[model samples]
Target: MIFCTYTSLVSVTHTTVVDAPILEVYSSLYQKYGTKLTCPCTNIAIAQRDFITLIPTFHQVCYSDFVKKSWLSYLNAASDKYLSSDFRSQGGLLFQILASFCRLSQDTIKNSLNKFYSTRFISNDVLDEDLLKNQSRSHIETYKSTTAREFVNSFNNIRDAISGNQLLSGFLTNFDFKPSKYSSEPQAYLVSYVSTVYNMPGRCNCDDTPSCIFPASINDNNTGHVILVVPGLYTGCLLVEAMRQSNLQCLYNQTCLNEIKKHIRSSVSFNSTALSSFVPSRYNASTDINQLLTELMVESWIENISHASYYNRCQPAHCVYTIVGKNNAIYIITALLSLLGGLCKVLYFLTLIVVKIIRRRRGKIVSIKFLVGMSEIYSILTL
Candidate 1:
């Protein structure tokens, strides 16, 4: 009987932004070792991790937008194919993308196999063999043999789970905040103040004065605030006073474009000037963001597969050899028949020997009886 251990999926709540240049490095590594990166489950896990890392960096930038749009388009186009057939297909684009982004460690893959299953499920001993040649085909069946369907099923499950999770909303919230300052000052003056304070460099030798030099008359004005955003299961946003003080206080607040406009209006002298001239803080409310998040979550589902003790138990063998036939029932029946035949032959030979001995003894007994009767008759005639 096969024994498997139950292992929980790895919890990945924290995320960090990985820049494009660094991702390119990982992509290069994947290309170099694509053949060695076997195991669909492990590949999926790594892909998920990569998506989790990349999704947070999505912004209004052209590259980010391109990635988001391209991926979504690919998904839509491949929807029918993905649903109908094995996911490892699609010109191997998904696999390539996943492989390019996630670098799988050999050790981690080796450790993820189930120990008991690994020892007994010996298909073929091709551990040192090159996998590149085998994986060249687009179809999953051409490569994975018995495991092709399983891999496809796992991929689907992950995709479904990610879609169900709705990860984007989980990580994001509506940006809302109260106005910090209101004034009747000129637009240029207000814009200058906001820009100057926002772009101020760190102080070298700090004094009791605030880092941002404000006008003396600005005592009546409200000091601006700094917003801190960090990535996590639930992304956290903290607002802190912009002014430097001995004890810093953080105000729990949400970011809103309207609040920013109000703050700019309060600080500006003109009432009619629109804040549209300045770039508004970009909020990610796009459906593309949801798609990206779902994709990432789907990819991350592979993490559970990679870490699962079942998959980790043993590396799948590429070949199998046996002295007996492949069919267990046939081999067992043949073996039993051979054993029974041998036993029957041995018994038949023993029986033949016993019959010969018994026949020889009976002949001897008859001869002895005849000789005794003849001797007795001769003695009686002589008398």
Candidate 2:
């Protein structure tokens, strides 16, 4: 009789909360301070610096206006749904602004710098020192003129591009600053919350005490749910769920069953001694693919835990240390210590009661004997 087992696919989900509002946290220093700002996003700092240095005319003429307009655009973009999907738009605005600068740099290198540098040393055989000096000076002057013209042209192109691009236009529009509903008073308390999901598959064995019970029919599907609550992220908690699959076919398709089978086969073939002994005797090659796939998926999910990066829009400096009035660890520790002090007082009182009882017993013996003797003497004198 051919026996088969089926397993369902599992689904997982997670959410993370941060202490600061998404908008203020992710914005670049340049967007916040303009010409007065230095780039805080290190990944794009070089491009930003190039843009600043090359576009001298823009800085002189339209820099202030650009900063104001971009800041407003950023606020509007925050209200859009797309913000949530892309880590609250970190470096998004800077990317848009720098796009034009990149394009200009590419053009300059291609059309002018490359041509000039290629030909500058082409006639290196000239022996005349005076001629070489004059020619070098001329080349340098020509290079400067070419770059100057390119810079002005690039600025114009960007300005014109801004007028037509809807996203850019919106970003460049001058609008008044209004705080988002998500925004809190800078001093308000905030907490970060994060969530993630994982899946685990059942194992099959044909032994009397098999790891998993095999159903009579291949159509039977079993499912299980697990919830894990863990403390994480600066006084916050994380919840993870491992969900069981209900449909065998659905699980197989979602997790790429065939790929997993091929990989397992390849691994076993390459490392026969190491893996051959571990293969289960009851494991039906065909029926066990579902189980193997589930195991693989669960392992991959677990491995992803170390690689996960939480979406945080807050500035690295202020966000790391900022806490609401008193919800922080320092206050919590103080409260715990106060409770411990009260417990110590109770313990001290119990010790005092025990000591007094022992002392009273000893004193009572002596006092009672003395009292009896005094009573006898008084009776004798009266008789």
Against the true structure, whose lDDT is highest?
2
Q: Estimate the TM-score for candidate 1.
A: 0.26
Model 1, 1-383: lDDT tens digits are 01111112222232222232222333343464443422222122222221111112222221222123343343344333322111211212322333322222112222432221232212121222223223222222221233323433544464445334422211111122235555666433222111112122343211122222211110112242332111110111101011111010110112332232232312112212212213332332322222332222122211111222222332232212212213345445665678679979999999999999999999999999999999999999999
TM-score of each: 0.26, 0.20
For model 2, how does the per-residue alpha-carbon lDDT over 1-383 read when each residue is reduced to its tens digit? Answer: 01111111222232222333343433332244333322122121111111111211111111222224443354234333332211112223432333333344445544654455344232311112344346555655566566656555544464445323311113211111343345356654454321111111244221111112212111111232212111110000000000011112221232332322222212112111111223223322233222322221111110111100111211222222121232345545565677678879998999999899989998999999999999999999999
